[model samples]
Target chain A: MIGIDLVQSTAETLMRKAAIEIPDDYLAGLKTAAAAEDGDLSSFVLEAMLENYAAAKEDSRAMCGDTGCPRWYVKMGNEARIDGGPIALEAALRRATASATSSVPLRPNRVHPLWRTDHDNNVGIGAPEIEYGFEPGGDWIDLVTVHKGGLFGTDYRMLFPSDGIQGIKRFFLDSLVAFGKRGLACQPAIIGIGLGGSKDACMVLGKRAACLRVVGDRNPDAKIAELEDELKDLGNNIGMGAMGFVGKSMVIDCNIEVGYCHTGGMQMSVHAFCLSSRRAVARIYGDGRVAYRTDPQWFTDYQRRETVEWPQAQTKSG
Target chain B: MATGPNKIRLSTNPTDDAIAALQIGDIVYLDGTIYTAREGVYMRVIEDRVDLPLDLPAVSAANFHCSPAATQHDDGSFVLGAVTATASFRFSKWIGRWLAASGAKLIIGKGGMSPEDYRDHFVPNGAIYLTTVGYGTGALLGRGVKQVRELHWKKELGLAQAMWVIEVENFGPFIVESDVAGNSLFERENAKIAANLEAAYEGTKPAVLKRFGETDDRKDEMI
Candidate 1:
């Protein structure tokens, strides 16, 4: 049996590291926002992102309570074997989930939709979610865990089949509009677009795309990255200024994830992350050893970046 | 005495009392106040037709609700900033009239002020709009809350209906949005965007032709 304590300790440490790294990306992204003329990434947006960060920090809780369906993607190697066989993965994951919940103080956001009750532990049927894959001839298991805070206000998107290839553009633009209508304006956020998958897979990948983004990073796909850059610039130019306050900086980065579709349908889903941009990508080996491949400080810093301040409570019209 | 407005600056940490005492015009130096609040509260005030408990007789000045933090002060007081809630657009729908009727002088929030309805209703009724720094909740809260007041929502409404009135101090060097004359920055920006887009469209030309021909003409190709 894998030592539950070991699994829990490792998961806790990874989450802590990821939390600390959120703010670094935030500051770097902010500079990008300031540089653009009409960028969607605005100071107002940054401020909002920072606000979420501060709340998460001060409260020391999940950055956003929406903490949607928890999901983890794990790649196991052939040599990997737990003392207890198949149940070992489940046990280790459960321990990891427990550690993350208490250590990160994650909001007890998971629940049974029909029952309308809080799981209180952020776990439910197939929750504290994890997906595992095994390699044929490797000695290490690679674990990538993501706890997405789905802001329905920002994450939900739909693309029509008839709109054709242009539908993709329309879907994105419409998502932006919907997000704005939801009052996500002036929120310096990251956009994640998931393409080609079963309906559920598309949604999952879209959110996962956001999780994969580096605080100061760009998408690897040059074309998609360029589009993200353009969108960021255009969004800031929307004049929704910080917190929609009217200074540049709206969205800092946009991430795109492409998934193979089982069916021949053009489907896209998008998710946005506020400045906190909290996500952890860790490699847990077959030995249950974990290492943060990306400097976790980025997530921490993104959470701590600054926002505009008010000088006083009262004011006179000029 | 310190120069300028009696500014109370909080770092990223602040005490509650400091946050509670916040009044319009007092420069609040804040260090904390994590931003929170979904659309629920604003909508409750806007579309639900429920009388807001947090609604005051008149707000000569007010700022809060972008972020809320629980913080401590050097002097051992608990303060919070960014905890105050105010959404200009949603509130302006109905409370704008209430503000005018109540002789409220200023409304401070993230987005700029609104339409003739607000201007005609409030300006004539004695109100102005101010824009506060959006992300500075932590900095403001660090200064300490000057006061915290809990308002009772109409009893007929559910528990979710209640509003909390938290007064903060030294919260801004905020900008003016709508004045007695009814000017608005949001409107100005939106209009400018239209003009700029129109001009850009008019100036647009075939990029390939412009780039190739502008370059030393390809003599061989032309021949």
Candidate 2:
């Protein structure tokens, strides 16, 4: 019964906290890229691309205006009960979307799929996807808020490992290379690697990997931590930059989700979420408890802050 | 760097006169007015409004709309996040004509238009178009805005789908798509695509892909 307000407030607070603000580092990087003549600012065809970002920032709104499918991920204690009324969650989510729209002024993104009509807020089937995890003995609830901007269309691509020298990792990387070479038009992509699973599961896992939290700092397992580091270095070396222009940062981050495969195929899928990287998370409690507070200072100036927890770097042997 | 405004007029309709004025780096703050019409509203506007809506103000710097949310500026006077989500190719008929007649001068969005939408409608006209980064919304909105006006589109279509009109203010640092000055970044990007394809076929490829430990030959030991 406790933490009920915390849960709703947490979601509300997180949404408020989730104001789609850009970090200083990103601004600096973009300014640097735009300064380069080779950056294509002079190109006649690329003018729309330039205006899109410029207007988006000048307006202080959702970057892409897509306000993509909203998805919520929650981890909480098993015994705790939500103190609020039964429909509080629905209310909370609605509030979250409203707050996001006003604060970030998200582009009223959600629409009617078949009718092709726009929903007042970006809320629709499978949208603002909510995932839940309940712990056995905890009293508090943790809520994660995610708002993926832009389309979830064909950007997700996959490849099969070619064997011999090529393994699962190679297969994943090759797909990225092919995508880039084909001019798939991706920006601020988070390369998601789905290691092993059935065809359906493998593909889904790969797509979900893009949603994983910041890598290296905190992973459920030691193996995943190691993989995160390797992938980060590998991705950056390719020089994909923020907008896929030539630069040092190809990927904002790389995430991997290893799902046990009951079958034998080494299936790998890669889903890329474009730069308007609009996603936020806040863990909610059954007792209506909430934790992660949005750092008010986060949006305007994103100076890197130290991790709140240090689990002592996992040894190679675990 | 700050730039001064060089005022030019345009219609929502893709007219030869409108497309002629926009240029790269030209600071444009559109005035007068245009109707807000996107995919849903575009179809509805054509079906319902035999003439431009009577209540809406006349749009001079009109930009064709795809979605209300995607409309670059809600109204000429307010500041809204102005953006063109997609191009005009997929839209129903009269999109170009709507722009031409509407007296709007600029079209903002991605991708280059065909000769029909470009040369026949945009280039000969004084209008311009601008494209924006498909990503980079965060960076875009960070700059700030002054006002927002909701355009009057057929709301019955759907709230999100309905194309309403409003105004935008303090719109700055935005790129020009097809400007009145005969500049089109859309064409430039397409040219790069063509070059990338030709180079790719010529056996010339970016060396960066090779630098990564992603090749088949190096997969085993690397992983």
Candidate 3:
């Protein structure tokens, strides 16, 4: 069993690390794009961005000024038990968020929607947004902390079942062009497209896909992989190089995550993150052992990293 | 400021000739002091018809469109943590006009102003919109920020969004987006993009026609 203390502590560690470092894979993507970028000026911009990330890591400050809003993706193990219930776990996560904000020096970015409002601690209603999924039978809890910066904007669109793939293409092409123009998105933008789901499911998938790694990961489904390839090819047409300047390299990569939907309708959402798409994943095993990963492994079915004995604490905690 | 990579230096005070000397697609490094402003405070300045919070002549008369993330100190001072530029195209209405009339030489931010705005307001006033890299906020802030001289409307607008007057030297390495030459990078590229996007959409037609169009017979009509 993962103790409540261990869970909170692990979450805190992951959030702090995410706030400071541009995850290894995202930084690698930037370096690759910089080398391949043809536009002289656009390449200069990419090189400078890479330099800036180096400075950020050296200085122990966040890579981008906008440290972004915080959220969580929790894969709950059916066989695992925590010391406390759901509410307590959430409360523990919130406490970790506050600690990470100050100790990690994450820029206090949360502001109230209304007048004279101040959420000084970066946590309020629905903040540190927690998204969850249940594993049928697992012994470890995985919490993926996503520190989303609002560099590029987020968008969602619902189409009639009639509006299928054409609708997806229209939404995607429009977003890439619009986001590509005017430096709205800091290109080599990673595009995340969600198709064939209800409104919430599509939005979540799109957001996840946008920040998910494109270097090592592969879309197992041939159809989805082809769609991803098509997205990358289509992005080149934008011609808004590096920072929307004239360049050959505009988009870094594109990932599409699909969910099953009824014949009723299709909902699609597009989420864009800057070069520094920030995220970190942490897993806690039954023996109070924990490990952190840069990749969240959201949908991938894989063997566990470390095998640990099932603790007697599970029965007592449950 | 670091040089040798690419730095086109511009002074705080420049004649019309100096401004016009720059062409489209030039990346410039600024060696001047600048005043910072956000939308809320600038809107107030426009509405109230007040002079800038900071004296322009005393401080290079340059404007940087940024909302620095700052924390207050015990003695009412601030240590700036993050100073990223906001998108300048949406900064305000009559921004180019206001900057030109006020004798502001350059505006630094992300996303260039429209060519129309530059031609009408900036060209006549001899102003240029300089654009900086979006994700390089840390590097920009790391270089040449000397002091947080003063702030305006902290109570009304809050610290992060409030207007701040800062002092710096060799403060930039920004691309010339809206230049005195009456050129906008986005506008030029937008034209090229329209051409490419049309071809791209057409290119996807064959691959997606079956799944999307529901049938080959309806494909032609679907597009």
Candidate 4:
């Protein structure tokens, strides 16, 4: 059985890591983007950002102030069982979040909507939103906790059947244009676009895509992958630059996740993550071996390997 | 409009002439004090107009729009983590008159503030909106602020949301985009930059043509 004590300790450790440390891959992506940034002013800004990221890790404080709302994605093994039930699991998670607030010392992000005071010690009504999945055979409980920030791109859109790819593109470009250069959300942003399925599915998938997918990774589907790359290029060409100071490297990556829908409308959710996207994952096995993960591999097995075939070219007469 | 190491220092609150003399695009290194403000603090200063928990003269001279990452102690003490700069667009509501009246001759921030009332609020009052550039939060925090002074609403508003008053010397090498003459670099330069971007994206339009129109069949919508 997976003990609640181990789960609690591991969760707190993971939360601390997510709060202070950035994953290696994400750092590499920022460095790469900064190195490739053109224009004198933009280059200067990118250098500062790199220096800041380096120092934030070394400093006794967090990298950015927004610490944001807490969220978790839980992938549990069918064979493994929690010592207690969901209540116990939630209690452990709550205790872990409180520890982060005081020890890892995350900024208190939770405030009551009406009273606006520390409630449940940063563990309020349904705080630290958790998404769950079940795997067939492992005896470990897998948890990925994200310390996410930014007020933009929280509530997304539902597209009609007529909206099509054009609608999705418009939604993206407009959102970028409206929100870019504001700096409330960091620049060289990584945007995740989710299509199809229910609203919740799209939002969750989009958020997972933003938090889990590394900056340079691409969807296996050729067309969607092409869209991803195209958006990146288009974003760079927009001239918002770093900190919107007239440069070329505004957005580093654009990720897309898709799901099937009932013969109905398409729900598109767009999640834009600032450069400081902080998240950490941990896998605790029933055998008592705990594996901590910095990289979030959200869509590990869902990659599409099937190639697309084109029909015969139309004749001149046609 | 030239770039140079224009190292200059002025009083916390400068005369209208001094403010107007500072041109746009001049890289400035501040050698004085600046306070912090955002949604919470702005409301206190602009709306509530509370008897600012600070020395009026020093605060009026300059301020930063940052909700710094700070940790509060039990006795209402705190230490700054990072002075992460936020965009000034959100502060547009009180960018004019109030800041001018408060004796703020300079405002430092990222992104930028609106330019609608620049002439009315900034020009006659002698103020400028400075943009922090090239430095990340750590660079700004390490080199800029020397001491974290008083924090208002520490126990009340939580850590990051409270009003932070900090001391600094040669705190920044910020760019002056808004001058006392009411000229805004962002307002002036945006059109030119947008034109250049438009030309570039127009060339790449054909590659992702499906994004604009229904070139492909509906059956292949998912594709």
Q: RMSD of each candidate?
A: 14.4, 9.0, 6.2, 8.2
Q: Give the winner by DockQ.
A: 3
- TM-score for each prediction? 0.58, 0.67, 0.84, 0.83
Query: Please, what are the lDDT tens digits per residue for candidate 2 over residues B1-223?
Result: 1333344433334345444445653434433333345566556556565555544324335553434333332343332333434444455265566555555555554333443465567656555555434433323422423234454543566544555454433332345545554555444443443333322223222222233334433111110
Show model 3 residue runs off by greater than 4 Å.
A1-9, A99-104, A114-116, A137-139, A151-153, A160-167, A212-214, A286-288, A301-318, B1-6, B12-18, B48-52, B75-77, B94-103, B204-223
lDDT of each: 0.47, 0.46, 0.69, 0.68
Q: Top model by TM-score, which number?
A: 3
List pairs with backbone clashes in candidate 3: B8-B29
TM-score of chain A of each: 0.71, 0.67, 0.88, 0.88
lDDT, candidate 2, at A234? 59
Q: Report i-RMS for every model.
A: 11.8, 9.0, 5.9, 6.9
**Worst lDDT window (10 residues) for model 3 chain B?**
B214-223
lDDT per residue, candidate 3, B94-189, as tens digits? 585467545787888877776667777777777788877754455456455677778777766666567677776666567777777678766776
Give the alpha carbon lDDT tens digit for every residue of A211-264 in model 3: 755544557788878888877767766565776666767667788887776687
Residue-level lDDT of model 2, residues A1-318, one tens digit each, is 654445555565555333344333333433433443243332211233355545444544445545555666555554555557435755676667655554445556666567766555666665666665544455545565655543332222233333311344454454554444212335435666666677677666666666544322324467776777666555544533332333344454666666565443455566765554444555454444344542111111011113454233421111
* lDDT score for residue B73 of model 2: 26
Cα displacement (angstroms), candidate 3, residue A264, comes to 4.0
The DockQ-based order of candidates, best leading, equals 3, 4, 2, 1
Model 2 alpha-carbon miss at residue B203, Å: 12
For model 2 the TM-score comes to 0.67
Over the stretch A20-85, how does candidate 1's per-residue lDDT look in tens digits? Answer: 334466556765665553433233334444555555466444443223344566655556655565
- Provide DockQ values for all models, in the order shown: 0.06, 0.19, 0.29, 0.22
